[model samples]
Target: MAQDNSKSELKLTKYNNILHTKIYRIEINDYQIVELIALKNGEYDGYLINCIWKINKNQNRTKSITQKIKIQNLTVKKLMAELENGKFETIPDCQDLKGCIEGLDGTTISFYVYKENISRNYSYWEPESDYYYKDKIIPEILQIREILKSINHEFDLRTSFAEFRDNLPKGKYTYGMVIIEKK
Candidate 1:
């Protein structure tokens, strides 16, 4: 199985011992990453990670820091409802991804649904605007983003990362991955 949250080591989940469907979205660019994972039982995990390396003045090395917060069951029902409301199953593949050029800067949004017998993942390579405010799967994905962002906002995620993305130094960064690395 491919690592959903792009890291070499596995990050243990609260319900890793149980059976449950996992629904998630990762909104990321060069500067920062915002991700949210929701379970059917209302367990949600979120992260606000900075892609730019931190100074780490004392250690003499730069590092990435992930600010994680766990929110219980408040928004999962609403999020799952949005996905059920003719959104996830009906949403078509993205056109931009098929003809996307590599090496150009743009925000990539990926959504996933995983379970014992179900595995679905969709991604888009946008032209980089609006933080997906006007996404094709609006009302569905837009609301999803809102809920995810709200969870991430608890960790201080920004309304926009475009403002100072270039002002920081790049480091170990992975899009759509739940980073647990501290080195």
Candidate 2:
């Protein structure tokens, strides 16, 4: 099956007291793997996270599969509280954060703020460690992973790269990407 690469606008019609909005878009095109939409919506009532992954590396196109998972109100309040505390802000010195991890590879991670209409993206090699990643990335990743586990979506993270990739499951063969957008 063919994948749709077009962009679509997000509509918010459910909750009126939208505390903030976050959109995470991860894309790794090394082996024709694209995960373009990972949206996390945090409102006064609850939270909603929608993630989609597409893998098309097989020679036989019919063997490819697209995985879509929706997580609703499962520890979203904790995530929202973290965001409210400014845990996603970029650190002043990238080198300091790098010390926490070793042997960085060629992966890309992005953080977009919908309310401010600003985005900050960097590759694995660019920063020593990301402020947002250090502060709340792990918890955020674990939150989703735990939820995924409960629903029988299991994947392993053997290396640092794998750990990072597993945090955001949207990619194909050699490369993986994860986007975190907060308003």
Each candidate's clash count: 3, 3
List, residue by residue over 1-183, the lDDT tens digit for candidate 1.
123343322233422325455544444543444444564565655444444334433432244434333433445445455555635534544543433323344555555555455666655545334544443444434444554454444444554442333343443333332222234
Please identify model 2 stretches exceeding 4 Å from their true place: 1-64, 83-86, 92-106, 123-183
List lDDT for all candidates, in order. 0.44, 0.32
- Give lDDT tens digits, candidate 2, residues 101-139: 323444323332333354543213222235435654533
- The lDDT, on a scale of 0 to 1, for candidate 1 is 0.44
Q: Candidate 2, 101: how far from true, in Å?
A: 10
Off by over 4 Å in 1: 1-18, 30-52, 55-62, 96-103, 127-157, 160-183
Give per-model CA RMSD: 7.8, 11.3
